[model samples]
Structure formats: structure tokens, C-alpha cells
Target: MLKKSHLLCLCFSSTLLSGVAIAQNAVIVNGKAIPKTQLDKLVQKSGQPDNPQVRDQAREMLVTRELIIQEADKRGVIQKESVREQLEQSRVGVLVAAVFEDYVEKEGVTEAELKATYESMKSQYSGKEYHVEHILVEKESDAKAIIAQIKSGGNFEDIAKAKSKDPGSAPNGGDLGYVNEKSLVPEFSKAMVQLKNGQVSD
Candidate 1:
């Protein structure tokens, strides 16, 4: 036989306690417990509105990520040989890059040093580029004959396709892309440099 006021107070106390427990159990991020706050922050950072549709999409994405992480954990993917190897490689790469960066900073690469290096090694870099066609023959004699045919206004590409031993260049009509002196063998490069543009050689 509780009084009406006492009964009301007891009910109110129970309700308040339950609310406090719920609040305590709730997870918070950035000192905020409201989902909308979280959504707003995400939207702000991403430059997109977390509308109902977007929220639903994000929820699905989070759920999928969680499921993947859970499955990975269960399957010990993090401890797998392949995964560990990849991680080790990544770690080594990062460490090497960091060390190189530190060394470069300490050594101080100057503009003058760079320019000097470039100038001294200019011949190593300098070369004439050519786009030439040729016929590759087994004997120097056959090659010489092909060169003669070319001098007599015969089509270099046609001759190459007809008699070139090199399968790779034969199909392309012996068209080698723009190659420089450095790109060719010593003898080949010397011969190439002696020729003018569009000139064929043995």
C-alpha cells in the first residue's frame, strides 16, 4: 500500500537509472554519441552529404568491411606466409626509402653539383636517333647486295620482308624504332651514325 507519490517517484528513479546505464554502454567517437554527428563529420571530410541514402550505403560498406575483417581474423590471414612476406617487403621498402631520404638530406644535393655531373657525362647521353629499315642477311656479301639494291632505288622494306633472317624485324619491314648511338652495338652504332636520315645500310 504505497502512496501514489511514492509509487511515482520509484518509477521515475528506475527509468532514470536505466537511461544512465544505456548512455554508459554507448560507444562514442570524438566525444559525441549521436550517429548524426559521426555522419556529419564524415560528410564534411568527404565533401558529400550523408543523406539517408548515403547513410544506408555507408552502413552497408561498414558492415561489409567488418565482415571481411572478421573473416580475415578468423582465417589468420594476417599470419599467412604470403601476407607476411608481402608485409615484410613493404616494411623493407619503406625503411630503405626513409634511409635514402635521410642520406640525401644529410649529403645535400646542390644544383651546381647536378649541373657539373650532367655536363661531364654529356657524351654518355648524347646520341643521334634514327628510324631506319634494313635487311638482315646471314653473310656480309648478301647484306652488301641488299645495300646495293637499295642504292639502285629498290624498296628496303620489301627486300627485308623477302630475305631478312630476323623474324622480328621482317614482319615490320625491318623498321627499327628511333634508336640512338648508345642503343646500338659499337660497330652497328658507328655505321648508323655515318648514315643520313632515311638512309639504308648493310
Candidate 2:
């Protein structure tokens, strides 16, 4: 019984409402509208297969975390000096990491820079590759102590397993396997090329 104009109007209204709902993908918790992006980010971080179950779990986690945060705010836990400092540090770390990632993606090494680096290190890359192992520590004092221990016949692999902070290589005795010298950072390449086989840098 609807007129042609009324039917067209109804269709238009339905299309707009559907578009808005699809764009928002809103998940409401109490009165809050949690963004779908947060759920997507959580799932990506979990490294799990993206399926309904994983999404449900992520949604539950977000809701619980939000509830706890709300409770903390109500009790003024965020006002504590130590908590404020920790939160600020976490914020800085996240922002700095994001900047580094964005910068690397948008400003990757140019061909000219690569050519210059290659030219400077051509001697080190004379058709010979090197297998590299390294133990990384935060302090020069720690590095010196490790070097001393190695000089006195302490096992390099054992020391690497115990002290190296590099998660990817530490478990494998700090072994980076075979690598092209040019692929290494300049300082590392310079030091590595100076070492004789089976010799550790002083």
C-alpha cells in the first residue's frame, strides 16, 4: 500500500543505517562503545588464527580489562605517584616504538646509501661469508667481564646462554649462523672482520 516515493525513502533510510552500523562495529560495555580496532589489535597480538572463538576471547578480555580500569579509576589508583610514573614510562615506550616502526617503513635505506656502504666495506665482503655468534649485554663492564671469562677459557656458548639478552639467538648459543658481512651494522662488521677464526674480540 506504500507509494513509490515512500518506498524509495524507506530504502534510502535502511541503506544509511546499515552503512553506519557496519562502519562502527560497536561493542557496548555498560555505557561505553568499545572500538572494533581494539579487538582486532588484540587478536593480532595474540598471534592466533582469526576465527570466531579467538574474537570472542579477545572481546571478553577487553571487557574485563575495561571493568578493572574503571574500578581503579573510581578508587583513584591512577593518582599514586609511582603508578603515574610507570604509566608515563609505558606511554613513552609505546610511542617511541611506533615512531621507529613508522620511520623505518617510510624512510628505508636508499640505493645511494646502500652503494656507499657497500663501497666502504667491499674488502670485508670479498666473496667470503662469516658465521657469527654474539653475547649482548647492556653494560660495557658486563661485556668486559664476559670477555675476560672467555680469555680464561670459560665456555662462550655457556656464557651466551646465561647472559645474552637477545631472545632470538641466546637459546641457540648466540648463533646467528652464516651471514654476509655487508648485511651487518657497520660497527659489528668492522669488529667481526678483525677477529681471526675461533677468536673472540678483546
> Which one wins on TM-score?
2
For 155-200, candidate 2 gives per-residue lDDT tens digits of 9999999999987788889999998777889999899999999989
**Candidate 1 Cα misplacement greater than 4 A, ranges:** 1-126
The 10-residue segment of model 2 with minimum total lDDT is 8-17
- On a 0 to 1 TM-score scale, where does candidate 2 land against the true structure? 0.40
Evaluate model 1: give its TM-score. Answer: 0.38
Q: How well does each candidate superpose onto the true structure, as a TM-score?
A: 0.38, 0.40
lDDT to native, each model:
0.65, 0.81
Which structure among the candidates has the greatest lDDT?
Answer: 2
Q: Would you give me the overall lDDT of model 1?
A: 0.65
What value does the lDDT take at residue 87 in candidate 2?
Answer: 98
Q: What is the lDDT of residue 7 in candidate 1?
A: 38
- Overall local distance difference test of candidate 2: 0.81
Q: Which 10-residue span in candidate 1 carries the lowest summed lDDT?
A: 8-17
Query: After superposition on all CA atoms, how large is the RMSD of candidate 1?
Result: 21.0
